[model samples]
Target: MFSGLITYLDSIRARDPAPRSRWEVLFYPGVWAVGLHRVAHWLFQARLYFLARFVNHFSRFLTAIDIHPGATIGRNFFIDHGFTVIGETAEIGDNVTIYQCVTLGGTNPTNGVGGKRHPTLEDNVIIGSGAQIIGPITIGQRGRVGANAVVTDDVPEGATMVGLKARSTLVPAEEWIKDFIPYGTPCDEPCEELMETGAGRLAELESQLAEMKAELAAIKAERAQPIKRNGTDD
Candidate 1:
C-alpha cells in the first residue's frame, strides 16, 4: 500500500507542474482522495459496508472528487483540479490522468442490479476537463479524451478523441507519451492560424462568386435585347 501511495505521488509530481515537495503532495486533494479510497476499497472487499461507505463519503466531501469504493482503480492514477466523478462500477487502469469535471458515469443510474454500469479506462488514458464518458464503454490504452467531449462508444488504443459526439484518430503512442497536451486535442499552433485563414478565404470566395453572377446576369440581359438592322424595322 505504501508502494502504491509512493507511485501515485510520483505520478502527480511528474504530470502536474505544481508540488515541489512531499509535504505539498500530502496536502493535495487527489493524493488524499486516492489514498483514502485504497483503505475504503479494502474495507469494502472485507464486507465492512458501513465503514467503507463512510470513508468514501468523507473523502468525497473533503476532496470534491467522488470515487466509489466499488470502483476498481489501478496504481499511479492522477485526478487534477478535483470535482471529477467515478461511478460505482467504473474501472480505471494504471497511469491514468483525469482532469476537472470529468465523469465516468452510467447511462442507467436507477438500476440496482449487479452489472457493469460504468465505463472502463485502460492504462495511460488521459481524460480532459468537462469530458463525459458515459455508459459501459471501454477506452483503450494510450487514449486521449479532449475537453468538453461526450464519448458514448468504445475508443481504440493510441487514439485521440474530440468533438461533441467525439471522433477518433490514431496517433503514435511514443509521440503522445513524449509530449503532453493540456486539453488533449491534437490541434497544433499552425492549425489554429490555418483555421482562421480558411474562414477568411471562404468569405472572400463567396463575395467573388456573387460579383461574377451579377456580371453574368447583365451580359444575359444585353444579349436578350433584339438587334435592329440598319434601314430595316422589324
Candidate 2:
C-alpha cells in the first residue's frame, strides 16, 4: 500500500504543476479520493458492499469527488479539482487524466442493471473539464475529450474529440507524447500551419460572398430602371 501511494504521488506530481512537494499531494482532493477508493474497491471485491459504501461516502464527503466502489480504475489515474463523478460499471484505464466536473455516467440509469452502464476510458485518455461521457461508450487509447464536450459514442484511438455534439479528428499519439495539451484542444498543427490549411476554405467563403454581392447589385439596378406602364411612358 505504501509503495502504491508513493507511485500515486509520483504520477500526480508528474502531471500537476501546482504541487511543490509530495506532502502537499496528500492534501489534494484527487489524491484523497483515489487513495480511499483503493480501500473501498478492496472491500467491494471482498463482497463487503456495505463497508465499501461507507468508505466511499466518507471519501466523497472529504474530497467532494464521487467514485463508485464498483468502478474499475487502473493505475496512474489522475483527477484535477473536485466534483468529478465516476459511476458504477464505469471502467477507467491507466494514465488517464480527468479534470473538474467530468462525469463518466450512464444514459439511462434505471435501464442498465447487471451490466456495463457507464463509459470506459482506455489508457492515456485525457478528459478535459466539464466533459460528460455517457452510456457504454469506449474511449480508445490516447483519446482526448475537449472541455465541455458531451460524448455519447465510442471514440477511436488517437482521436481528439471536441464540441458539445462531439466531433472528432485523428491526432497521432506520437505527437501527443511530445507535449501536454491544455483543454484537449488540437495543438498538433501550429497556428501558421492551421492558417495555411484554411486558405482554401477562406477563398471559398470569399467567392460565395462575391456572388451574393453581384446578385444584390443586379437587383438594385433592375429596381432603379423606370417601370413600364401599359406599354407607354408614365
Candidate 3:
C-alpha cells in the first residue's frame, strides 16, 4: 500500500513540476480528494449510498473537489488542482490527468431514467482547466482537450482538441510522440504557424469586404445621378 501511494505521488510529480518532494505532494488538495474518493467509491459499490454520499461530501468540503461516489476511476488518475467536478456516471481510465475547474458533466435525459450520461475518458487522456466534457462522449486514448474547451462529441485517439466548440488541431508527429503536454495544448511552431495563417486569412477577408462596400457605394452614387438627354442633365 505504501509502495502504491509512492507510485501515485511519483505519477503526479511526473506531470507537475511544482512539487519538490513526495511529502509536498501529500499536502495537495487533489491528493486528498482522490484518496477520500477511493473510500467513497468502495462504500458506493457496497450499496451503502448514504455512507458513500457522506464521504463524498466530506471530501468535497475538505478539498473543494467534487467527485460523485458513483463515478469510476482507475489507477494513477491525477487531478492537478482543485475545483473540479466529476459526475455520477463518469468513467475515467488509468493515467488520466485533469486540471483545475474541469467538469466531467452529464446531459439531462428526457426519458427520466439514469443511464450513461457522463463522459468516459480513456487511458492517458489529458483534460485542461475549465474544460467541459459533457454527455456520454468517449475521449479516446491519448486524447488532449485544451483549456476552456466545450466538448460534447466523441474525440478520436491521439487527437488534440482546442477552441470554444473543441475542434481538433492537427498535431505534429513529434509533438504527438511526447508522453505528456501541459494544459493539453501544443503551443509550438506549428500552432504559431496556424495562428499566423488564420490571421492572414481574416485580414484578406476584411480587405475584400471593404472593397465590396466601396464598389456598392460607387454603384449607388452612379444610380442616384440625374438622367441625361443626349449628354445633357435632365
What is the lDDT of every predicted structure here? 0.84, 0.85, 0.93
- Model 1 Cα displacement at 178 (Å)? 2.8
TM-score-wise, the better of 1 and 3 is 3
Over 29-83, each residue of candidate 3 has an lDDT whose tens digit, in order, gives 9999999999999999999999999999999999999999999999999998899
Give every collision pair in model 3. Answer: none
Q: After best superposition, candidate 1 residue 45: deviation in angstroms? A: 1.2
- Which candidate gets the maximum TM-score versus the true structure? 3
Prediction-by-prediction clash tally? 0, 0, 0
- Native-to-model Cα distance after best TM-score fit, residue 103 in candidate 1, in Å: 0.7
Per-prediction CA RMSD (Å): 4.5, 5.9, 5.3
TM-score of each: 0.77, 0.79, 0.84
Best by lDDT: 3
Local accuracy of candidate 1 as per-residue lDDT tens digits, 98-173: 9999999987757667589899999989898999999999999878899999999999987788778987754544
Query: Can you give the lDDT of residue 25 in candidate 2?
Result: 83
The residue ranges of model 1 lying beyond 4 angstroms of the native Cα positions read 1-4, 109-112, 169-179, 187-234
